[model samples]
Target: MAFWIFLPITLSAVSLIGCWTVYGLALRFNHICSLRNWEYSNSCLTNKTVTGGCCTEYNIPTISGSGTQFPENSLFSATINAASFLFVIFSIFHYAHILKKCTVHRFFSKSAMVFGCLAGVGAFVAGNCNPGELMFLHYLGSALSFVCICFYTVLLTFLTSTCILTGLERFLYPVRIVFSIVQVTLTILYCIFFTQKDFYYRHISAIFEWTLSMNLELFELSYAVEFYFFSSSMLSVLLSNRDEENTMILS
Candidate 1:
């Protein structure tokens, strides 16, 4: 039970760190590529030329091309795809373990299971969605991934709040509350700004055109929330032990 909480946290931390590293590398590559009027190949770093193969005159790299050279954003996107898929696997394993223990509330356990399934589905859908294309299927997959993250965020927030309110522990309530608020806010904003047709086509595309490509921020935030939740849970266990010790001494 104790280990289960740590698993998600550990995985999320690793993912977040990996994402940051990828982002940095991508940025650096973009800088170098800009000087050479070169851009990263979409999908992978193959050396072949495809449609939209070159860096735009404006210095922005295209998403698809030969795999020989990768732009920073392309590399970041690939890393995110890989890390997110791995995290989904860890989430499923952690949820399954918790389900076996059944120490948490029935609702929490069931919710975790559902969220785990959704995350897996999201990963699958997103994997199939091409980053370089603006097709409906691509957007649909992205939307599904966002939805899965939102659902999981809500369930985790609810479970954390329940733990706080039920007097499970005291010292970690602040952390849990902050974690819940951030995740809820991110989820709501994502639905409104990224997922909705009005915002996606009208606002995002009109203004930034590449708004979806910048979803790295959301990914980082999601991982941050997961890490905090795991840390708070582990801290709660420690606080519980201290409380028991005090109670025993007082009695």
Candidate 2:
């Protein structure tokens, strides 16, 4: 049970740090970027300049090309897709186990499972379809990924709120709800503004996109409490014995 949480948390941290590092480095080396800044740009015209570095933000998905080199670009995209797939897939199994233990109806678990898998597939599509190359497909994948992820988070938050599952705390429900709201709101705003032709709109949208990404990563980190409650070794299935389970059962 603990390792389930720890693994996802570690995955989120590594993915966030790795993507940020590569994007920042690539932005630094992009001499043709006009300025080394961090805001999103509708176009990468050499005249654009931001405060920190040269930023040619199209959509967040295009960030993989920030490195402006094959190694940097490919590495970032691959890292993102791989992490997204692995984390989501593992999460599906984790949730499935919880659902089984609780004897949750198939509908609730199926919704989460389907959306979770879709989110993973969306990530893979978005990561692979470079905005610079396949603009339409990239945006499509990004849209799907963001929307599905938002719903997925909300569903999981609801699941937590029910308090029917073991190894989760009651107090965490409201916190998860708040985070899910923020994530969904940002996703909506980003979709609206990210498509605008104006510079400020695009820049603001980029910030929204970044915020949403960081929010998801941070949300994943909150599982540290769950991680602390169990041991790492075979913890996923080594749930409490029947006697202990009887003691903890809510009803």
Cα-based lDDT for every prediction: 0.45, 0.65
Weakest ten-residue segment in model 2 by summed lDDT: 30-39
Clashes of each: 10, 8
Best by lDDT: 2
lDDT, residue 249, model 1:
100
Per-residue lDDT of candidate 2, residues 71-178 (tens digit): 576777867777777767655664545544555554665587678788888877878886667878877887788888888888778777653555555778878888
Clashing residue pairs in candidate 1, if any? Answer: 26-72, 40-71, 42-63, 42-64, 42-65, 45-67, 45-68, 46-66, 46-67, 46-68
TM-score for candidate 1, residues paired by index: 0.51
RMSD of each: 11.1, 6.9
Evaluated against the true structure, the overall lDDT of model 2 is: 0.65
Output candidate 2 Cα RMSD.
6.9
> Model 2, residue 201: displacement in angstroms?
0.9
- Which candidate has the top score in TM-score? 2
